[model samples]
Target: MGQDAIAPPNGITHIVWDWNGTLLDDNHANLAALNQVCAEFGRAPVELEYWRAVFRRPLLACYEELFGRPLADEEWARLNQTYDRHYSSLLPSCRLADGALQVLTSWTGRGRTQSLLSMAAHRHLEPLITERGLTRHFTRVDGRRHDGAHDSKAEHLVQHLEAQGISPSTVALIGDIDDDARAAREAGAHAVLVATGLMSRARLEATGHPVADSAAEAVAMLGD
Candidate 1:
């Protein structure tokens, strides 16, 4: 809502991408790290199938549900700290989804405006992007401020748009889940979803929302 209302220059640039499931194909990493944390804290680990279903706002909300109560500030920090450690160890095995790098490369070639807005903590997200050699493709990478509670990706997207002077008309939110689509709508930008994320093709299609099968397709749709 705080963003400028004008349309972007006629060329159609300035993209906002969702990282997990969208870019890095790291939802499995998240599930693995979180489950590892659960084990460390004497809680049951959630399966990836369930994680895909319950992952949502308030970063710690899903964990709280699994832990049966809210974690203390210290406990929350420990979980975050430990999760990063576990996730980092597993990063070598993480792979970029099909066409992700190519799409990012195509966008970068034009020197367009772009950024990464994700629910994953900034600490972990940065290194992952850097390691994958995808950091250079984006003009900016933003995540939660890490102030204990989970930061909503929607809020981050709105803030980033305001700070970057991006207009809603020119900016399209590219993501792969309902949350991503909802955040784009909330931020007054077009939501262009990719089916490659945690969401199923059927579910994505069922929404009757504008969607792409891959990042390349998203880039093409945005050009239209």
Candidate 2:
């Protein structure tokens, strides 16, 4: 049987969700924001496929890849500010992914505990979640502190699971990127990558985690 046929661990009492590309359908906004920055830098605009294929953590690395060279600290900072400004402006046009509500509702109905973890700043993340009316579905919403650094989620995952008193083995992380799977592994939790997010199926599959095409499919893999 294929890897997708493999069942999730038994007794999955909790789920950790990655908010950006996973729960929120902000991929287009992300791409547009990046393209806006590229325009300012006189760089070629990146297509969605290119964005999906090359996106990764340590945000600088992704920028470097796109620019074809290392960015000076000052340049990186400006690019970050530019992208954030454009993305925030585009937020009003963003929406939740298809079937995301159904999946969250079904999981909640089944008495499953769910929490949101994101690399976005806490100040920004909470407002967006609240504005979307998704606050009630999550037991906790953890976002990065306003340190102006795009760090990995591994450390956050460790702290989040520990604070919740949830065993890693009894939890799964549903996300869209390899960093998400890496964070889940670091926390000793199962990683389920949904293809309907920022990264492409090929990239997510390269992480050797089960890849689902949608939130509903991811829930099916996690099981009840």
Candidate 3:
């Protein structure tokens, strides 16, 4: 990842949002779900704070971090299945992040463009957003179509913009992890990292992007 800080937000034509921890306030569900699977692996349950600190992209790293051992290929698949099962069971109770709707509605009302790009499986991602009546807010919503952990959102962000026929330089991505900032930079896009998702505020800030307290603040910081 690059060490340079993000450029100031200006000339942004569209906003790209992250799913999971960014827009969806699913930390409780995520923690509980992982813990559910953790128990099956003979690991102890993790609290929200601990989960925030350790969670990372390439999810296998997170699994290895928690389990304290290298995972075999088959074990990785089993862990993913178990985690997905528990996470799916918890989906119904998950809620959107605070001010998430207002940010989306205000942007839509202003007639600006926005979309969703995520590491979440598309099958789960699209339905969950639709379930909350949020499908109308975005120009496009994309998630992983295959089964496996993601290493970065860079390539996906490029493809997401390409599908929308939007230029990367004119877009700003609002997401909650270091990977988000890194991805934006890699994809030639701007970024505003929000602290409402999985990663801690300190960790988000460490990426050298503009870090916001919440989604609303992220947009405001972007001069919304």
Candidate 4:
């Protein structure tokens, strides 16, 4: 396995969902912003198919791959500043995909607990959630910050578990990338990989993790 493989433990009551690609369907916007940034520096931009394979990591790693060169710390910061400026303007055009809100609402209606665990910085994620009117659906929302690092979803997941006074055995991580599954496994939580984001079914299944077609299916799988 690429990472540790694990099964769900008993009493999985909470769900932590990945934000951008999984819940928000912002991959198209993200790819556009990244390519736009790359073009400014005369770097070849990544295609949709190619980006899916390596889009889960931190922004700097994704930028380095596009430019075919590692950026200095300051250079990376400048690029992020630029990207954030462009992306913020584009946020108004973004929205949740099919079945995303339904799944979330279903859980909320049933009084099931949920939270957001994402690699996106809190500034961006918070407004998006508010704009989409999803803030009321979740008990907690955990995200990266502008001044702090959350290079991986795994780091945020650990912090969320501690802050929520919950254990991995009582929670599940729902996301669209291998990193999501890997993070859940490492944290001893159940992972429900969804196909609605960047990764395909083949890639998710290859990791030996359970996969769902959409958020609705993921929610159904957790049913009574």
RMSD of 2: 2.6
Q: CA lDDT of each candidate?
A: 0.74, 0.85, 0.86, 0.77
Tens digits of per-residue lDDT for model 2, 25-63: 988899899999999888989899988888888888888
Candidate 2 yields a Cα-based lDDT of 0.85
Error of model 3, residue 186, in angstroms: 0.8
- How many clashing pairs per prediction, in order? 0, 0, 0, 0
Instruction: Give the per-residue lDDT digits (tens) of candidate 1, residues 100-199.
Output: 8888887878777788888777876787778767778887888766543335566678887898888876788888877776677777777677877666
Give me candidate 2's TM-score against the actual structure: 0.93
What would the per-residue lDDT of candidate 3 be over residues 112-205, giving only the tens digit for each residue? 8999999888887888888789989999999976543357888888888988899988899999998898889888999999888789988887
Ranking by lDDT: 3, 2, 4, 1
- Which of 1 and 3 is ahead in TM-score? 3
In angstroms, give how far residue 78 of model 3 lies from its true place.
Answer: 1.2
Question: Which digits, one per residue and each the tens of the lDDT, describe model 4 over residues 150-171?
Answer: 4666766877888888878878
Question: Which regions of candidate 1 deviate over 4 angstroms?
Answer: 1-12, 109-112, 146-150, 198-208
Residue runs of model 2 more than 4 Å from their true location after superposition = 1-7, 146-150
TM-score of each: 0.78, 0.93, 0.93, 0.87
